[model samples]
Target: MDARQRLIETTRELLHERGYVGTSPRAVQERAGVGQGSMYHHFAGKADLARTALERTAALERERAEALLGDASVPPADRVVAYLRRERDALRGCPVGRHTQDPDVLADDGLRSPVEQTFAWLRQRIAGLLAQAQQEGSLRAEADPAAVAAAVAAVVQGGYVLARAAASPEPAAAAADGAVAMLEALRTPPRAPHRA
Candidate 1:
């Protein structure tokens, strides 16, 4: 791959493994196998490169989500579960969540806007799906779909953090699966009393 592509991929790998706080420009350069000059030529600095890399990561994630989301022939609950169970290259954390935890990134408007936008976008998309579920009568109507969407986002993100800290996938998967199961349980027959 070209130097720019290499640099972005290296940045993404480091960010996922080390987080924005732990990743260093030197580490990124070394990982990309590019000289300092080549790296600089492609990006203004670590922050710039990180922004680009993060945007790419968010785009990829959204695309993955959209694929499952658009396939309406599939059952709604199945789609929700499949979206959560989708195989991830690194199951440790959400790229958007990673950016949110970075104090430096949060402090810089230029650096953080995309990160904020990423979550806002994902949350909105989740809300839309929840609305669809509600309209389809697969999800209960009492619970605010936005609130439930936020909760779902929390499970996925919190699961990632727990997975990384615990150094295992079990915790994350359980939490993620449990959240979806809880939502699945919300489904009820029209005559059945709905549960939130």
Candidate 2:
């Protein structure tokens, strides 16, 4: 690979392993086998390289989520469950989530927009599903779909935090499983007609 590609690839790996705060350009250079002059020639500095790396991470995440949610022909609830259970070995938060938690990372608009947009798009996708469920008479009218969608998003995101803080992926996985189960159970069903 070329020096710029090597640098971006190394940056992605380091960012995922240690997050933005812990990753350094020198470390990336060492890992990528690229010299400082070469890396600088391609990227203005650490921030620029990191931002590009983050955008790549965001794009990857977007692709994954889109595959799960963008296929409108798929059943909504099934899509939700499938996304939650996607082949993740641990609840290491989404790459986008890890980036947003970084102070320096979030402070940059160029870097932060993709992260913000990912969640925003996910929430809307969930909301649309909930709306579809409601229109189909499979979800209760009493609950607001948008609010429920937001809660769903919150649980998944917060689950990552809880699991990471506990140093165990179980809590996060459990939270996701539990939320999905709850939503599934709460699905509306036809009531038996009352006999006179």
> Residue-wise lDDT of candidate 1 within 56-156, one digit each (tens)?
88788788787986688987656767777776533556766777787877888877887777678767877787788788877888867788778877888
**How many backbone clashes can be found in candidate 1?**
0
Candidate 2 regions exceeding 4 Å error are 190-196
Candidate 1 C-alpha error for residue 93, in Å? 2.7
Q: Give the least accurate 10-residue stretch of model 1, judged by summed lDDT.
A: 87-96
- For all predicted structures, in order, the TM-scores are 0.83, 0.86
lDDT of 2: 0.81
Cα miss at 24, model 2 (Å)?
A: 1.9
Off by over 4 Å in 1: 88-91, 190-196
